[model samples]
Every structure is written in C-alpha cells, then in structure tokens.
Target chain A: MNTPLLTVHELHKYFPLQGGFFTSSKEKCLAVQDVSLSLHKGETLGIVGESGCGKTTLARMIAHIEKPTAGEIRYNGQDIFKFDKKQLKAYRRKAQFIFQDPYASLNPRLTAGTIIAEPFIIHRRNLAQDIDTDLENIMKMVGLSKDQERRYPHEFSGGQRQRIGIARAIALRPEIIIADEPVSALDVSVQAQILNLMKDLQDEFNLTYIFISHDMGVIRFISDRIAVMYRGRIVEMASNQQLFENPQHPYTRILLSAVPRL
Target chain B: MKASPVLAVDNLSTWFDTEQGALKAVDEVSFQLDAGDTLGIVGESGCGKTVLSLSIMRLVPTPPGRYVSGQIALNGLDLLSLSEREMRKVRGKAISMIFQEPMTSLNPVFRIGDQISETIRLHQGCNRSESHHKSIEMLRLVGIELPEKRIKDYPHQLSGGMRQRVMIAMALACHPQLMLADEPTTALDVTIQAQILALINDLKRAMGTSVILITHDLGVIAENAQQVAIMYAGKFVEYSDVKDLFSLPLHPYTKGLLHSIPRIEGDYCRDKRLPIIPGVVPELSRLPEGCRFHDRCPDVLPICRNVEPALIGQGFPKRYVRCWKYQ
Candidate 1:
C-alpha cells in the first residue's frame, strides 16, 4: 500500500568455483539470479523451490546475512547493504533469522533461556534489567513453559526445540522474520502444530514473514502469497489463492500436483 | 492370469532391547504383495515404515534388533529361517530395496555404472562386459540419457534426481520379484519426483514385479498404489483399496492425517486456524494402552482407552474400524 514494507530489485548472488588458490580458472555458480519480490508491512511471503534453487540465497540476502552481488535491497526505504556498522546494529534488532535445523542452530552449550535472550543481551544492553521478563513472556508465547528455560537444546524433543528457536527469533520483537524450512525436520503431526503456532504469532505480533520451504503443503498453510522458484528464477508469483487455484506456470502446477491431497 | 504371491509378511514384530526397556519398532505388522501390484505404505516418520521394509529383507542388525516372532515368506520360502549368507543371495536377486537418501546409499568411491554392473554380475552370474551392457540397459529403463557415457560418472556428479535413477537402476538390475522403494522420491524435486514415480510404475507393469512403496505422501500413493496400508504407532490402522482409503477414511487417526494434508482444491484452507490434531505422538516405548491413537484422537471414549480395537472387515463389503464408536 505505502511503498511496500520491503522491496528487492534484481538481487543476485554468485559463488566463484575456483580450481585452487593459485589456479587461474574460475567459474561462477549462479545461486540467485535476478530475483525480485516485495512484502507488505505484515504480509507472509512463501518461497517454494527445490533444493539448491536459490530460495535460501534470496532469504539470506533479504536478511542481510549475505550481501548481494548485484541489484538493490530497500528495507524501509533504506538500502540494507549501505548501512554502516551502527545502523546495521540497529537493523539487526528489527530483523532475525530462524534456521531450518533447530537442533543445529541453537548452541548445545546454551540453555533455552540464554538462547532466546542472546539478541536482547547483544543489542539492548541498556535495558539489561528487563531480560528476565522478556525471557518468560517469549517462552509462554511460544507455548513453552518456564520450566523449560533451564534445559539445554538436546534435553527437549524436536518439536520443543523448534519452539525454543521460534522464541529466539521473536525475542527482539523483530518486524520481519526469515524462516528457512522451520518444520521440515519434524514429524507431520508436529509440523501441523508449528504451522499453527507461526500463524498465531504472526497475528499476535503483526510480523512480516519470508517463509522458505520445499513442502508445498506447508507453504500453502502459513503463506499469504506464494512464489515458485525454478532453476534460478521465480517461475510464478501470486496470492496463495491464485497460485493454488490457477497456477499458470507448468512448474507450479507440477509442484501442486506433487503435494498429497486427501 | 494373475501372478502368484511373491512376498508375504505375517505378524512380524521387530523390537530393540535397550537398557531403559524393550522398544518395539515394528509391532505385529503383516501384509502381502502379489506380482505387479504396488502396495503403498503411508505414515509419518518413526511409524516403522522403514523398519518394516528392513525386516522383510532381514537387514536389521541382530545385536540391537530382534525379529521376536512371525514368518516372512517369499515364494513359500521363509526368509527368517535362512542364514545370513543364504539371505544375502536371495536379497537383490529376488527382493531389492532403494533407500530415500541415495547419495549416502551409493558408494562414492565407485562409478555409477560399475556399481550397477557389479550387482548384475553378482546376481546374474554374467561376465564383466555382459553386466556392463545390462547396466546401460537398466539406466535407460530408469530414463537416464546416454547410459553408456553416464555410467562412468560418479554419484556426486549427478543431480539428486539422477542419483535416484541410478538407485532405481541398481534395484532393478537383477529383475527382482519385489522392489522396496523407501521414500525413493522424497528428496527429489516435484517434477523429478513425478518422473521417478512414473518410471517405477512403468517398470513394474512391464516386468510384473510387485512393489512396496513406503512414503508419507498420499499423492504418490493415490497415483501409484492399488492397495494402501495406513500405519500409525507401529500398527496398521486401516488397509483398503486406494480409492476407498481416500474417499472414506475410517479410523480417526487416518482421517486426521488425510485432513491435515493441505489440498490444492476448493474451500479446503478456508479455516484460518488450521485444524491440527492436538499433542505429539507418544514415544513407541510408552505407547498408550488400548487404541494407540486414543491420546490424540478428538472423539476419544472411555472404552477406546481401555480396550484394543481389532481390524475386521471382509473384502469390499463394509468399512472396518477399531473405535468403539463404530461398534
């Protein structure tokens, strides 16, 4: 509506395939090529693709974890890559990433409470007294009890560990979240629970989501709009209704056909 | 004329003896597959779909896993009665399996062609050059282009879809009576997945090889299998024609699984608050008494919590259910 919340124009990420440090032969691997998309203030954008299809690269570029090789990323009318150290620090407070494998994402040495509070500890040092309250509220919001705060990542089940990851992502009350295959590691029943939780949190916090997943069924459930990526481009992008009901792209139709229906 | 029964698994139970307790990974699972029939096994992870397949092939380690009881008969020969050495001969030649992760399954040290040819040589008692020729043929059957040249390539050089085709080629190398595909297409992309499924269907029809396709995706089941077995908590909740299972899912757990799947059709996702069956499945070691699904079932009754329900129904006459509500 109002110049869209975030705009990505002609974003590109390429990794050079080199022989060795001394070798002159260098071949560039195109990961994300000329990709572009935008999200409203609180809209959920579903990015669907096969493995190595550049969806993850696009998400990382949007989150500013990886700088783009070409094109523009406008976050709130400011170029994300152009931000200096201090401005970048402020931007990190408003954006967070939830990795696919919660078991691997969370440090084995850290407890659930510490993992969730790490962002606040690093960014909001002046408000250190509020960490305890912040930890409890985030825990409850993610459907985890206060007792779980003291436990390590391995002590909890896969589903519970993912809840801790979700809590950590929302710890700073970020305006946008890039969730990369959040529930792909869990069981089907547990996957449903996490999807429902994500939807509830989106409504409660009005957070914009860039959801990436290979599972079409899951993307359809939590996404407002869906973008189907192929080889290295967005083959189709439409509202969830339009994409699911009338997918124009052959790849999108094939993807929809692959998802198991009752 | 219908081909006779190839593999018949009866009341097979696989259990692991742990210090904590005895965990039954596959509890009293039984089914049969005739020639040219694809029986699809659908269930969530940890539901023993893989374990059931492994047990049929006698590949489970005896130190951790014990078959406990039940007969696994393949063409009137009891597989469980055979020695490890004897079973090894029967495996791959008579019954072969293709795993989900093909990269790990294939030996990286060897060429894809050599691997498939090795299997052919071992089972078919052919020369190196003859097996090499057959390997190329198998690759072509799996829809790989220029099998003669591609055979020399390593597993890592191929894409995920191509690696899976190599796995299928190896499984079909000996013209086995039964091929066990354990989520064969799960790791591949959607378009590639369709291609793999179609390849398996074509090969099965042409060779009259019975197939057991184990996957959680019902779409594959619908498009491939003639008979479907729905498993939950290590037991068959429902077994019916694929059409019947899709149209009238009898068990509450089966219904929940089917409903939970997001459909790309009309009016399905209207409910903004996604209908999720509450609570995670209890650990297999600590499964609920009586009906295994009673804990998470929405329509749970007192009797469902106390007594186990039996699978009862004759062929095509009526629906069979375990819940007391049906009674």
Candidate 2:
C-alpha cells in the first residue's frame, strides 16, 4: 500500500564460528539467509519458526538493532543503513523493540514510570510538563493502574512486567513495533490478556506489528499474514487463511501439522 | 476388593512456611492414576501442578515445604510415612520424574551413558559394566540414534531435543511403575514436542506404567491424557475424562482456560479480541477470603465472594467441579 512502510531486500546475517583479533577462520553460521519481506502500514506480519531458525536475527536487522552482513532495509523508500546520524536517530525513534523476556528486557532497579519515561527522555522530547500525565495514560492503556508506576520490575508478575514492556515500547507513539515473542514467556491466561491488549493498542494507535512467535496458535490469532521460516529462510509466505488452509511448502505443512489441536 | 490404582493422593496439602504466612501450594488435592493411564494435570504457572507432583515424589524440602495433612499412597504403600532413606529407594524404583528443562537437569560434566547408568546402578544395584550395557539399551529404547557412540557424548554435545531424550532414558532406566513428567516438552520446539510426547505415550503403553503428565498446554493434555485434572491455586477445580472435560468444561476457571487459548483450527479468526480471564493468578500468600478464582470468574455470584466451594462429586464417577453454582 503506499510504497510499503518497510522493505527488506536479500537480507543475510552470518555469525562468525570463531572470533579473535588475528584469526580469520572464515567458518560462519548462516543465521538469516536471503530473507526478503515488505511490511504494510497497519498490519501484523507473523514470523513463525523454531528456536535457532534466525527469525530474531531478521527482526534485529529490520529494527537496525543488528547489522546485516548482506542486504538492504529501506524505511519509506530510503536505505536505512545509509542514513546520517540524525536520520538514524529519527528512524530508531519511529521503530522500537519489545523483547521476549520482560524481566530481562526491563531494568530491575528502575521504577515502572522511569522505564516508560526513558524513551521520552532519550528522544530529547521536552515534555517535562506533560511527561507524568503521559506515563500514567500509557500505563492505564496497558491494563495497569497508575499506582503501579512506583513499583519495580521484581514487584510485578510476568503479565504485569510485559504490560510495562509494552508501555515502554509505545511511549514514543512509534508507527512500527518489532516484538520478538513478547507473550512466549507468559502463562496461557495471561498470554490471552497480553494478546488482547496488543490488539487493542494496535487498533487505538494504528500501529504496524512484526509479531514473532514459535506457537502456531498465537501467530494465527495475531497475524494478518504469516511467514514460515525453516533453517534460515522463509519456506512459505501467504495470507493467514491460505497458509493455514493450503500451506504449500512441505516445511510449512509439517509446522502446521505439529501444532497440537484440541 | 478391586485392584487399587497405581498412585492415589488424598487431601494432600503441601505448604511453604514463609515469614509472611503459610503458602498453601497444594491444598487438599486428591486424585488417582490407574495402571498405564496418563493423568494430566493442567494449570498455568504457580497453579501447584509442579508442587503436587513434587509432593507425590516426597521431594519437597522439609524445613520450608511441609505437608500440612494428606496421604500419598503409591501402589497402596504410604509414601509420606517413609523415612528419607526408604524414600530414596522408592524414588527411582517405584516413582521417577523428568523435569521441564533438560539442559539444566542433565549434568554437563557427566557423559550421557554415565548419567543414565547411574540411575540403574543406584536403583537396581548393578555393577559398572552391566549398568553401562543397560544404559545403551535404555538410550535405544527412547529412539536415540547410534546409542553406543551417542552415549559417550556429554550433555552439551547433544541438541535440546536429544538431551530431553536422554533425560527420558534416565527416568525410564529404572522401569518405574509410575512416572511424573512436569512440563517435559515445554522447552522444546513444537515438532520436537510432538515427537517427545508420542515417545512418552508409546513408552507408557509398552511398559504399562502409570504417568502423571503436568503441563500448561491444553492441547498436550487433550492429546496425551486419558483422565485430566484442572488445577488452580493449589486445588483441583475440575477433574474428569479428557474428552468429557473438553466437550463440557464445568468450572468457570476450566472453561475460561479452554476458551482463552487461540486454537489452530476452524472458525478462529486473526487479530480479533480473544476471550480473556480478567486478571492474573493471585499470589498464594494473599489468596482471597472465599473462592480463589472469584476475582477472575466471569459468572461470579455474591455468595462466591465470601463462601468457598468444595470439590463436588461422588468419587470421580463422571466429573468434579469446584464451584458454588455446581454445589
């Protein structure tokens, strides 16, 4: 739609097998190989894969959290790697990441308010007057009370910690969020709450989501379209209905079949 | 009298004596598993599924974790009455357990063969060469390839799935009459999860061993267990046949748990709002006055806020539901 919100061309990330200052063994592990995709303005793109399949590497490269060995990422038709310092900062501001482990992602020492307000402070947004009000609103939107702002990460449950993570991710009102298995670490009942909250937030903010998860049920429930990755490449990409119904690739079929149904 | 079940637990309440208060982790949980039948304990984290299993195995550390009151009978023998020395003998012989994380469970320094054979040596009193030979057979039984060579490799040398298989081999090495698998496949991939589950099923069938399968996934419970117990806040909220429970879940907690999961099947759309239980599982230290699930129950009555409901059923004939409405 409108030149696609984000695009990746032949993305490749290779991790060195052995690293030393002098040794150049040339043996590398292909984490992400020849991955390519385009994100729409306000749609959830699900990337499903088993552990060690390099979906995280792809997400990191797209968010510019990690550098790709070979490929190009264009945000609004301009190559993000070629961006100047200010342009990079602006791009980073528009794109934020939510990690799988909420406990690890958040700083344990800081209060919830401080963690959520860090984005605004780091972006150099002069919201000293309205920052408190904004933080409270974000917390409320994530199904957390305003009183919880004073609590530390250790005080919150797994679900509440994730809510804090989401509050931080959306603090800057980013157009795109690359969430790497955000609900994987939560319980099923809590997972449902977090998933519903994400949907509500997406509708309210009109944000695009790059949802990555290993659970087929979660990906099916959240994504508009799905990409099934095997080894280090996308074996199949299709609309949610088509992928679940048809699933052309053998690996995709295997993945769909592996999911235990009630 | 009819033959007794392989394992029977009655009014078992495992509590942790904390400075704040007594945390009832497994409160008055009662159930039984027959020969070769898998009794699946379905619950989210901190719902006491793991604690119940640990209580059965008599593995809970005593100073902190004390059984308030109950009986844990394995093959009609009271396990709770056993001394630590005697319980040690019962552990790997009559009962065995496999934990969730295989990587952490397996000793990194020990070779796979040594780990598996150690159980055999400790339980069966076999010599080193005999134990080593039995270890190879055990590995082969669990479908590990090249058992002779793979047994020499350390825990780190194996993949996550392979390590789990090794763990299974060690657990089954003693050929225990009953097995406890606590989230055995939780850390593995879905495809590997399926394989491990299928392997457990096949092993149970072949060995005629009663299994207590505990997990958070309803799908796993539906596929694996014959009888199912839905645990919440240290109690069995719902207990019934897997088919009956899935077809007609009675407890609000059980029903909410069923509806909460995003099924990978028909009529489930993408990105639509899912049915959710209102809040998180309450901390055991500060559980509500009356019903544990009343705060999150969609169909809460005024009585539910003040009066707790007992698990209502006659000896698990059809089903048991712990709800005021049912009572």
Candidate 3:
C-alpha cells in the first residue's frame, strides 16, 4: 500500500574464474544478471530455479552477504550500498540470512543458546530483560525447547537445527529474512513443521521473507509473489495464483509441469 | 503362477550390533517385486530404506551390520546363504545399485570410460576394447551425447545431470535384472530429476529390469513406481499399489506424509498451517515397547502404547497396513 520496504533495480553479480595460479581471468561467470524486484513489508517473495540458476546469489546480494557487481538496492528509499558506516550497521540489523544447509551454517561447538544469542551479541542489542529470557523465548518461538539450549548442534535433529538457524535469524527482529532453500534438506514431515513455523513467525513478527527454493510446491505454499530464474536471469515474475495458473514464461511452464503432480 | 516374481524378501531383519544396543536398521520387512516392476520405498532418513537395499545387494558390513533373521531370494536364489566371494559374482551381474550422490559414487580419479568398462569386464568377462565399446553403447543409451568423447572425461568434468546419467549408464552396463536406486534423483535439480526418472523408466521398460527406487519424496514415488512402500522406524507401515496409496492411504504415517507435501495446484495446504507429523523418529536402538509410531500418531489409542501391530493384508484390492487401528 505504502512505499516498498526494499527495492532492487538492475541487480547483477559476477564471479571471475581464476584462469591460472597467478592470473585473474577476464572470463567471469555471470551468477546474477539485471534482476529487479520490490519487496513490501510482510511479503514472502519466492525464488524458484534449478541448481546453478543464481537464485542463491540473488538472495546473498539482497541480504548484503555479497556485493552486487552492478545495480541499486534501496531499503526504505536509501541506497544500501551507498550507506555510510553507521547506516550500513543499521541496515545489517534489519536484514538477516538463513542458509540452505542447517548442518554447515550452525557452529558445531556452540550450544543452541549461544548460537541464537550470537546476533544479539554481534549487534550489541540487549533485547528483553535478560539474554537467557530472550534465548528461551526465541527457542520457544521457533518450536524448540528451553532445555535444548545446553545441547550442541549435532545433538539436534535436522528440523530442530533449522529451527535454531531460524531462531538466530529472527533474534535481531530483522525486517527481511533471506532464506535460501531452508526446508530442502529436511524430511517432508519435518519440512511441513518448519514451513508452518515460518508462517507463524511471519504473522507474529510481520517479517518480510525472501524464500528461495528449487521446489515448486514449497515455493507455492509460502510465497505471495513468485520469481522464476533460469541461467542467472529472472524469466518470469508474477503473483502466486498468476504464476501457477497462467505461467507466461516457457521456463516457468517447464518448472510448473516438472513438479510431479499428485 | 505370476512369473514367480523377480525378488521375494521374506521377513528381512537387518540389525547392527552397535555399542548402544542392537540398531535394528531393518526389521521384519517383507515384499515382492515382479519382473520390470518398480517398488518405490518412501521413508525419512534413517528409516532403513538404504540398509534394506544394501542387505539385498549383500553390501552391509559384517562387523557392524548383521542379518538378524530373513530370507532374501532373488529369482529363487537365496542371497543370504551365498558367501561373500560368491555374492561378488552375483552383485554387478545379477543386481547393481545406483547411489543418491553420483559424484561420490563415481570414481573421480578414473575416466568415465574405464569405470563403466570395469563393470562390464568384471561381470560379462569382455575383452578390453569390447568392454569399452559396450560402455560407450550404454552411455549412448542413457542419452549422453558424444559417448565416444564423453567417456574419456572424468567425473568432475561433467555437470550434475551428466554425472547422474553416467551413473545410470554404469549401473546398466551389465544389464542386471534388479537395480537398487537409492534416492537416485534426491541430489538433482527438479528438471534434471524429471529427465533422469524418465530415462530410468524408459530403460526399465526396454531392458525389463526391476528397480527398487528408494526416496523420501512421495511425488517421485507416485510418478515413477507401480508399487509403493511407506517405511517408518525401520518397518514398512504401508504397502500398496501407487494409485491406491495416494488415493486412500491407510497407515497414520502414510497419511501424515501425504498431507505434509505442499501441493502444486491446490489451495488446501495454503489455507492453514501445513499438517505435520509431530515428533522425530525414535532411536533405532532402545525402541518403544509398543507401536513405534504411537507417540507421534494422531488418534492413538491407549492400547497402542502397549501393543505392537503386525503388517496384515486387507482382502480385495491387495494392500497391507501395519497399524493398531488396522489390526
């Protein structure tokens, strides 16, 4: 209704392949190319593509995990890249990322409590009465038990480890969460639990999400708007129903039809 | 009566003697597969689906894994009774396996041509050039372009899709009667997954090879398999025709799994929180005394906590469900 919470224009990212030991190659692999989209408050933007389609690169650029090779990303009408040190720090607090691999993303040695509390410590945002209280609340918020705080990452199941990852992402109360294939690693049953939990958290916190997955069914379930990427380009972008019902792009149609119908 | 079935697994119980008691990876699992039939095993991780296939191939390690009690007969040949050296003769010749991660399964150091030819030479006892030509033919059959040139490439030289195709080529090199494809497309992209699955289906029909396709995706199973087995906590909770399993799932676990998958077209899953089967799979060792699924199952009765359910077949339309409710 109002101005978009975040707007990306002409976004591009390229990784240069090293030709030799001491040579910087002129040949660069274009990971993302000229992608533009706007995300409003509380909206879930689903990006679907096959592997090596650069959807993850787009997510990384949006979350400020990686700098775009070319383009403009404005957060609340301010250019995120052009922002000064203080502004960049403030922007960091507003956006967070949930990686695809829960196992690799989480620190193995750290307890569940310390992992969730990491953001608070990094941003130095003293949230709530005490750190333990916040930890307990975050754990419960993500459907984890308070008793699990003492356990390491290896002890938790695949689904529970993902919850810990989610808990850490939302601990800072970010405006946007860039989740790259969050549930792809989990079992179907556990995937349901995580998707439901994400929705619940989205409703409660009014958090905007950039949910990326190769799975069409998962993308359709959680997204308000969908973007179909093919070979580092956005082939199509439409609302959830429009994308499913009347897929305009050939790639989109291929993707939709590719999902084995039940 | 019915071509004598390609494979018959009678009460297959593959247990491991772990330090934390015996890990019953597979327990009392029984099923049959006809020639050219695809039996899809759908289960969560650690549900013994992989172990079941390994047991079939006689691939499970003896020090850790042991066959508690079972009869695995492939075309009237008892697999468990065969010695290790004897089993080797049957492995790639009678039965071959395709693993989930093609990258890991395919030897990176060796050329694709050599790898595929090795399978051929080992099983069929073909000469050097003869095996190479046969492997090239296999590659071409799997739809890999320029089989002659591509065969010279290493595993890493090819893409994920190409690598999987290579695996399929290698697995089919000897034209084994039974193929155990464990999560064959789980590591692939959806589009590539579609291609690989279609290729497998085509190859199966042409070669008349029976496949035991193990994966966690219900959609994949529904599309590729004739028969479906729903495994939980190391036992098959439901076994039925593909159409019947999807249309009318019997066991609580099957129902839960079906509902859990978000649909592509329907708005049912969108209206509410995705219906999930709560709680994790209990440890294989030190399992609950009663129904293994009782703790997580909805509509569970008090008796479910105290009673174990045997898999019983329902008359008319051939389906078996292991649940106290069915019992």
Q: TM-score of every model?
A: 0.95, 0.98, 0.98
lDDT against the true structure, each candidate? 0.86, 0.92, 0.92
Q: TM for chain B in all models?
A: 0.96, 0.97, 0.98
In model 2, which regions exceed 4 Å deviation? Answer: B268-271, B314-318
Poorest 10 consecutive residues by lDDT, candidate 3 chain B: B265-274
Here the TM-score of candidate 2's chain B is 0.97
Q: Output the TM-score of candidate 3.
A: 0.98
| Clashing residue pairs for model 3 | none
lDDT tens digits by residue: candidate 3, A100-137: 89999999999998899988888875544678788888
| Tens-digit lDDT string for candidate 1 (A1-262) | 4778789999888888875878865688889898888889788999999988999999988888998889999988899999999989878878889899978999999988898888888876776768988889999999998888898999988889999999989998899999999988887767878888988898889999999999887887778898899877898999988988888999888777766555
lDDT of 3 at A46: 93
Measured as a fraction from 0 to 1, the native contacts recovered by model 1 come to: 0.45
**Model 3 residue A80 lDDT score:** 92
By TM-score, how accurate is candidate 2?
A: 0.98
Give the per-residue lDDT digits (tens) of candidate 2, residues B30-60.
Answer: 8888899999999989989998999998889
- lDDT (tens digit, per residue) of candidate 2 on A104-173: 9999999998999999899976869789899889989998899988989999999999999999999999
Residues B198-247 of candidate 3: C-alpha lDDT, one tens digit per residue? 99999999999999999999899989999999999899999999999988
Native contacts kept, each candidate: 0.45, 0.77, 0.82
Q: Candidate 1: RMSD over Cα atoms?
A: 2.0
